[model samples]
Target: MCVYVVDDDPRICRLLARLVGLEGFEVHTFEKAAMFLENLTRLKFGHVILDIDMPEHNGLDVLDHILHQKPYWPVIIISGSTAMDDAITAFRRGAIHFLRKPFRRDDLRAVLSEARKVGVKRIAAYELQARVMQVKLTGRETQVLDAMAGGLQSKMIAWKLGLSIRTVDMHRSNILAKLSARNSSQAVAIARGLGLTQ
Candidate 1:
């Protein structure tokens, strides 16, 4: 995966590029947020390491831009100063984590690991929403599939939905056919993979 480093400090940028690269990531360093936004579309994979202090446009503004554009792209905020307000703002703006400058490599690694896990879930949810639209699943069918996604058996689903087992089975079959899944497990697999289930 790629890692985009947005920091005005040349030394910090180079250091991060080298360190992240050593960890097997394709690294891209940007001196400013505008440049990153200009080429945001081409940045298709992985997360971003953003410095909270920058000239002209602050890191919070950049974070807002990123959130407005592609909300799924995980961002880790790094700052030289220990401003609790900034850290709080970053988190509220959807930053995965806020790291104080001169952070340890291990800490950064842990944050990245968590961010990637979140990114995968976001992607799955997005895919599931798209598939729901494409398949034209009714609200009732969606509820049944959601129950199945939670590993509920048809009879339980029927009871929960106040329907007959036969109706539940019919809904399950329709869900499987619409999703192009052969069996309950396959349908549930799609649901799980697409993050339809909690």
Candidate 2:
């Protein structure tokens, strides 16, 4: 598998490339988001190790762009700061993990393992998408499901979609039932696999 490491610091990029390369994976390092985006089309399949703080465009913006193009893409956000808000926001933005800088090698390994599992899940989701489209969801339910896949809470979804909280809750329930998902996260996963997020 290939791994794309995006960080402003060349030293950090080299460290990650070396560490990941040692694992028998092809590693590519980028010092800027534009460079990364330029080369992204060449990377058919891979996990991204993205640093959150970068000049020109922040990590979140990059992440947003990536997800817009590929919702099921596996991205792990890394930063020097341990801000809880940032971590939460990353998760809400569909990051697999938010790792702090200077992380232990074992931690990196663990995160990579988790990302691999997510990759597997994404493949399965793609397969399931074909079947999922058979289920009929109303326009609003589809909209709500799309929002849920974006990691938005019911309240936020309601506000964004200009619906009542009760309506959002109802749509969430219907979406979960239709998708056979136990919760919002699973529903979102299924939605992502179905290519419904874009």
Candidate 3:
């Protein structure tokens, strides 16, 4: 499951994300409501925790905009306000829950768990459509690549594959030479673009 937090306060955003992450949800933090909204269509966050008091855009306004774009997006609104009117306004504006500021970890965890239960159906379906790109390699070189992908050094790969380290290095050189990659990260990215890890 994924969780998104949008707050003008970067510290709060980071803290909340870390808390959610501890609950086993993948977390993404955005300092501005506008930036998060820009990626709303392309990004599928399981649950969104929004701050109502952001400088540029109010949380309810952002939520309304998101709903206008995608009616059923799940969200929770957070605020320091204790006014019943604010909570009512949040619900009327389509917030899933109203979380007061300085919420307890257990409460957040429970909310996140509930969000995942609801969001997993969609996340699972999307995961099937998602692809992880891997590097290109021949049958033999693929073995080498997979090992390297695991962070095994050349000597370790060679030992695992019953080959000399020099042989492994030669294969690595050939692989890099063919792919025109400056390093492993670049190679992995290029391979992804070409759809190698389907």
Which candidate has the top score in lDDT?
A: 2
Candidate 1, 1-198: lDDT as tens digits: 778999988899999998888887789999978999899876776689999899857899899988788788889999988779999999999998999989999998888788778889887767677886677677888899889877899889999999999999999889899879999889888766655555
- Clash tally, candidates in order: 0, 0, 0
lDDT of 3 by residue, 27-94 (tens): 99999898998998898655789999887997788989877775555778889888888789988988
Among the numbered candidates, top TM-score falls to 1
Model 3 lDDT vs. the true structure?
Answer: 0.77
Q: Each candidate's TM vs. the true structure?
A: 0.73, 0.64, 0.59
Q: Where in model 3 is the C-alpha error above 4 Å? A: 120-198
Give me the runs in candidate 1 sitting further than 4 Å from their true place: 138-177, 183-198
For residue 105, give model 3's deviation from the true position in Å: 0.3
What is the RMSD of candidate 3?
Answer: 12.3
Query: What does candidate 2's lDDT look like per residue over 51-168, in tens digits?
Result: 9888777899899888877777799999998789989999999899989988998899988988888987986776577576687889999899878777789899989999999999
Sort every candidate by lDDT, greatest first.
2, 1, 3
Scored against the true structure, residue 3 in model 3 reaches a CA lDDT of: 82
